[model samples]
Target: MPETTIKGPVLVTGGTGFLGSHMVDALLEQGVAVRCLVRKTSNLRWLPEDKIELAYGEITDRASLDRAMVGIKSVVHSAAITMTEDHDEYYRVNETGTKDLVKAAMNHAPDLDRFLLVSSLTAAGPTSRDYARTEEDREEPTSLYGKSKLAGERALQKINPPFDWTIVRPGAIYGPRDPALMKLYGMVEKGSVVRVRGPSQLVSLIHVSDLVEGLIEALTNPIAVGKLYHQAHPEPITWDDVADYCAEALGKRTTKISVPRTLLPAVAKGAGLWASINRRQNPLAKDRLDDLLQ
Candidate 1:
């Protein structure tokens, strides 16, 4: 497919999120006009206000999505809840919300050129260190979040929309302003890391800049239409690799300790119980504990 002229703004969902905010920056830096679909309650601290339009909306609402899709040339759906004890919420937001957005774009944006979905490697589960997961592999999602992401993909595929579309699944994205890695960086600054010596699975990592580049590529490249790509550094890394780099970056001597696997179940249960009592998310919920090992 030859590239069409970009005649309208690119609408981005979750523009205030860490990854979404980076996407916003990349779009603006490249001279594309951006319109963000944002809720009134969303934080704009990570988002820049200049040269951008804000369209108040929610993914689950058709009317709001309709307003956001007006004069939109393309859409980048990047919103999803990462932590939730209720499995239904994942399906509601990731899967159902995507269906609504795709429908709105199809119904509202007559000249839409691209519709890119920023999924995650968790949707494909994991592989041994010897074999990196590829787009050709059959998906075997091991977590609720992964299943919801896969569901989102399936929801769009079911529509069979008449437009250029692609999917990019990224792994463990880390960079400046990302809070997920900050805790580990803080621990490294204090001179220690907790290592779980168990199954020792392979994991992939990508920088925010590289992943944002991949996102733009998937939109502009004709070869990406109806295709799936896994974007990551060309290698798999282990926890030891992460620890050493963190320590090196912080210039601190760090102690690494091996923790017993038996200790996790109790911790997970205790955390789950406390969360249920307080209506808060457990950092060590069973799924999260499984995530730490798997």
Candidate 2:
């Protein structure tokens, strides 16, 4: 198939983030003019120094979004916070921020061909079976992050004078630049015993490259419009197996140690408390203990 000509520049929010940076690279490689909207405080080391446009804006500010949308025909709404102590912060950035972008896209880029929202597999909640999740499943997010994303998805659907919208819910995305996965890799590299909170629980995952490909495909494919898609690498690996993969990647043996499920709550609770007291954010909050066991 001939490549779809992106008639105008492409706008990428959260362009300094892990997945967003990859998406920016992918768009640039496709010979598409990329415009990145990022906060003033965001680190731009991952982004190229040339060949793209930059717009300083935060998701919370609706007024500045119009500047980013100018001359952009495709909007990849990747701006979102994954972890936060306040649930309201998640809603503000993930839901309200998304709504603002969609509205801005409609007003500024009236002829926009696509608006892609990068979401997460957590939107589907924790599944009992090991099978890969599909787009048809009901969204029952188990965490504030997931819940806020689902809310964003719902808000996007209600946009007036609608543009083509595709929601891609990716599983645990892992790659070189991923902060969370890198921590696991670091632990394994240090020969630390990796504890498996739930040894038998299976979770889906995708490489950052694969996910970027999916996002680009969704942008041009009419089938993706007004649809939600779940993405993985066609395989689901357990948490224990993930540690083993990291060990193998690092040329080390897996230090598999099973932590009892009963103790996970206490551990998570303590971690949460420590994070709270330190005014730090912990992704592994108490609510995650149950999902960890699955």
lDDT of 2 at 103: 84
lDDT of 2 by residue, 223-294 (tens): 777888988877787777788777887898755666776776787778888888888777666544444554
**Candidate 2 least-lDDT 10 residues:** 285-294
> Candidate 1, overall lDDT?
0.85
Give all candidate RMSDs, comma-separated.
2.2, 2.3
Model 2, 196: alpha-carbon shift in Å? 3.6
Please list the residue runs of candidate 1 whose C-alpha ends up more than 4 Å from where it truly belongs after superposition.
1-7, 270-281
**Clash pairs, model 2 backbone:** 201-294
Clashing pairs in 1: none
State the lDDT at 25 in candidate 2: 92
Question: Residue by residue across 212-248, what tens digits does model 1's lDDT show?
Answer: 9889878787888999889999988887788789898
Report the Cα lDDT for residue 181, model 2: 90
Model 2 deviation from the true structure expressed as Cα RMSD, one decimal place: 2.3
Give candidate 2 regions above 4 Å deviation: 1-3, 262-266, 269-280, 287-294
